[model samples]
Target: MRRHRRAKIVATVGPASAAPDKLRALFLAGVDTFRLNFSHGLQEDHARVHAAIRALEQEVGRPIGILQDLQGPKIRIGTVKDGRLDLTAGETVRFVLDGSEGDKQAIPLCHPEIFAAAAPGQDLLIDDGRIRVRVVGLDADTLTAEVITGGPVSNRKGVNLPGTLLDLSPLTPKDRADLAFGLELGVDWVALSFVQKPSDVVEARALIGNRAGILSKIEKPQALERIGDIIRLSDAVMVARGDLGVEIPHEDVPGRQKELIRACRLAAKPVVVATQMLDSMVAAPAPTRAEASDVATAIYDGADAVMLSAESATGQYPVEAVTMMDRIIRSVEGHKLYRSIIATSDPGEEETPPHAVASATATLAEAVQASAIVTYTTSGTTTARVARKRPAVPILALTPHLATARRLCLMWGAHSVHTDDVDSYEEMTTKAADCAVQEEFARSSDLIVTTAGIPFQMAGNTNNIRVIQIQ
Candidate 1:
């Protein structure tokens, strides 16, 4: 199905939607990108999903982007003999690095990296911030914390150390293995989780080494302090709000999401707003009114894509969740407020000559009422520049590289197609106009604005723009 809206949808694949038929249905429903969450499923599970996506892409004649999200350093408490501990508030709990029985006295908290960084007065959020603990004392290989708010503390519950930047590599051993597996599987994007600073991104980039696009998942409060540096360093960014809400106050998530999206747009990097967008749809066929409004808010804030986590991955109503999210996005995009939001949003920092030239293509297209803005690019930056413009018209991005075409699925307002390299300017214009007509984005004699570099093979050399009539 053809989507009129520019913003994309990313749906996570899991047991509920791993079948080939279900995946195909989701693709036809409006899932522009498929996310293989590396946290849950096994390598074989992802292989099946990846194969299904490839088959669907072949059948649909469109490029689909697969994002493999690496599970970073996830710290959790060790298990007890009786399986659970009901600790009272204002009681002391000993977090020792030993395989001892976990009772009211002390449990095994084996992550020494966190303990090394532990200090007095630091808050330790356990089990998604459900249980709050404050560090009172630190000894050799042990941390004594006072339970500020206590509940049933179970085994393997997650631990979040807010306001404390631990000296830990973002990628654990599992993440490295998963990254190698995902690269072998040929995924388009790799999302690094829990990035705290620019150095984290640089380290991950060194490992990724241009094999795929590296997307930084912003879930830690420390990442926000250096967000601009992170945004500029990574190819894309994901506003991973699940842990972000835990790290920061719940009331601050909305503003932080907007800030991150704006930062990505300023750098022309695609940003995805993720986690609990349509939470109610996980169990019910319809989403709550608040859920609908939440999604609309993301779209209005000019995010390139909105993601569904449990709502699509393991929900009882996976298809229904995807359908509802698709409808909500379409409805919001068609609203009068959507265009006003795009028009009033930041115009982006156009630094280079190609950038300035690409920015003008939008205004010219709107003035002339062109059917589409056609971009012939080598590195996909030209189309990304146009996408940030949020023109009233659609963008047709033609590239010779299949990887570029697949990665463009995350871009707002970009419809990328793989084609042969253009030898001259005339070939570029012809391909752009032909694609506009063939794709039915425009008709005969319809005006099309085409932009590309002079030497077609050279990357980041977009320096020309032309208005052509489709023959």
Candidate 2:
């Protein structure tokens, strides 16, 4: 289907939208990619969803993207006495490193990594920061902390230690297994959660290789410290704002979001703004005004895509949420100030032949008011570069590789078509014109800008651009 807007929508699959018919409805409603969250479901459940998506792709005659989200290390307090404990503000509490049940005196914290990394004076946020505590003292067996914010500390509530860098790999044994399964299932993208350093991405890259794109989730405070290196190492990035908000100050999230989007644009990598974009849609048919503004803000900042988590997963209005997100993007892109705003934030091209050609292609397309900017790609580099420019016209990416086409679905303004390889200049232009017409990108006599490599099918060799008028 042709999307009037440039930004894409990624929807998570869950019980609310896991049926084949529901999946098809979501695709028709404007979902560009499907994210399978491994944190909540069984392996069999995810496998079923993956199979259904592939089946839907075949039926629609379009390349659909599948993203496997690995559940990283989960740190939480062990079971509490009577399943709950309340610590009032300013009260002293002790967290012991044992698996036994706990009371107001000694709560069980089973993870030793937190103890090893944590120290006096650092704040410990529990249960999504509802219950805050400041570390007063620590020993090999226990951490003595004073409750900063009083609240009930439930059994196994998640623990967040802001500013403390734990010596742990983002990947757990479960994540490794999930990664292997996703790779075997032919997912287009793998999103690694809890990424703290560049080495975390490197470790995932070692396992992923060229099988799928590695998308780092920038939800850790440590990740923000080395974002540039992390972005350089990752194929793509996601602003997972849920856990991110808990780990960092909420006021700083917006600035960090803008910074990430700009960095990804400058690097020509896709970035997805996720979490609670339409959160209220989980129960209500329409989202709150602030939530609508949140989605629009990301589009205005030039995010490649905005994602739906519980809104599309277990929400009551999955299709409605997708439709609303689609409308929000179209509205933002059609705003009078959109063009100027995007251009203002545009990162100028790098000093290289490919970058120069890509930048020129966008400039030339706008200058000539072309119908579309068509790119021939094998590994999607040329298309990504063209998209980074955020050209006025839509990007029609023609690729012979289905994997490449599927992966490009996550990029901004990129409409990927799986076509046969073109061998020569004559054939390339002919195919470009044909696909443009068949895909309804342009009508007869309309002009289009086409880009490709000289060696024909070689990857990462973007060296040519031509403006062709449909016959």
Candidate 3:
């Protein structure tokens, strides 16, 4: 369904709200996209949510996007000997990866690769950094560590290496299976978690094969380092603040979040601000003023979407959370500064390739009074770049990736269409104009802004810009 506010709301579906009726209420409450966290629900449960979303789309007479978030490689300690281990500060604990039978003295570290790359003095955060430990010694099968902080560590507690580069891929075996299933279900978007580099995006895209758009979750510090490359590769970007906050300095997260949104906006990629927006709403009907301000800031920053995690998935007030988020977005969007904040960006020192193309498209769109701007993007980079310009017309993004289309749902003034890639710029523009007219998205008399590369090469190869009349 078409959202009234420029920024969109993305609600997670979980046990608290998965039924068709409940989902319909969420949609009515103003959820533009539905996020199915593969980390929690079963495939059958996801199928039900998918069906409900499709049904609701029909009922509402508008396309609703579905994002299937893959549970990426999550390294965790195996079952504890007594189901829980309490470590007192200054106590030494050993993390072993030996195939030896489970014992109370040493816990089985599922990821030995972590030890190979880890160094002494590196901090290891367990269970969301609840239990802090420092690497003391390294061995083939065991990592000796002294507990720096005392806490109860339970079964399958997650392990986080903040700065250390673990010798492990982002995708796990389970993620591959989930990706296959998501493709079979024809999901609109697939979110890859814990993305450390641009190569991760390429590998996932190769597997997805244009089935769905890829939204790389920028959570780890490594990801922040390679953001420009990742943005060039990924279809969209998600500021996953949960793990991000855990990985980086908490205070730095706010500035990083704004930076990411601006980067995506400059690239015209849809950026979603996710995690803990209404955390208190998980149990309370009302959100704290801080939470409201957090959401308003995202909207004010011109983020394409603000996401809810536990607030809607397992929260006591799922509907209310969505309602509140919707109200906050609407309120923030009403402010004249909202559009200005979204439009205002650091002026480019020079016209880069994508920036030059985007500036040209915006100028042409205004000059020709175009009804729409049609962007053909392979990795959705060119599309995002154009969107950053925030032209005074609808942007029709045509991509071969479904995930890109779904992700674009959150972008300002963007309407995504799934289409096969064109081999030539001429074909791409003509087809875009034809689709715009055929779908009644634009009229034959309407001028259309078109941008693409001459040869339709790699991602970020946006060099062409034109204004054409729809026929």
Instruction: Give the true-structure RMSD of model 1.
Output: 1.1
Name the runs in model 3 displaced over 4 angstroms: 98-104, 346-385, 391-407, 415-471
User: Per-residue lDDT of 96-191 in model 1, one digit per residue for the tens?
Assistant: 877666776678898988788889999999999999999999887889999999999888999999877888898999999999999998999999
lDDT by candidate, in order shown: 0.90, 0.94, 0.82
In candidate 3, what are the lDDT values of residues 1-471, reduced to their tens digit?
345555778899999889999999999998888999999878988998998888887787556789999988887888877688888998888888853334435777878778788889898999988888999898777888888988898888899999866666778988998889888988888999999988999889889877778899998999999899999888789999999998898999999999998888766678899989999999999999999999999877768889998999999999999999999988887777765665676334235867787778876887878877888876666776776766656777788765566666766666767787677767787899887886566886788888876667577788888878766
In order of appearance, the predictions have TM-scores of 0.98, 0.98, 0.83
| Residue 457 shift from truth in candidate 1, angstroms | 1.5
What's the true lDDT of residue 313 in model 3?
A: 91
Residue pairs in candidate 2 whose N, alpha carbon or C atoms collide under 3 angstroms: none
For model 2, the run of ten residues with the poorest summed lDDT: 97-106
Q: Report residue 269 deviation for candidate 2 (angstroms).
A: 0.3
Off by over 4 Å in 1: none
What overall lDDT, based on C-alpha atoms, would model 3 receive against the true structure?
Answer: 0.82
Where does candidate 2 stray beyond 4 Å?
A: none
Q: On lDDT, who's better, 1 or 3?
A: 1
Question: What total of clashing residue pairs does each candidate reach?
Answer: 0, 0, 8
Which pairs, if any, clash in model 3? Answer: 212-403, 213-403, 213-404, 267-384, 267-385, 268-384, 268-385, 269-384
Point to the candidate with the largest lDDT: 2
Go through the candidates in order and give the C-alpha RMSD of each one to the true structure. Answer: 1.1, 1.0, 4.4
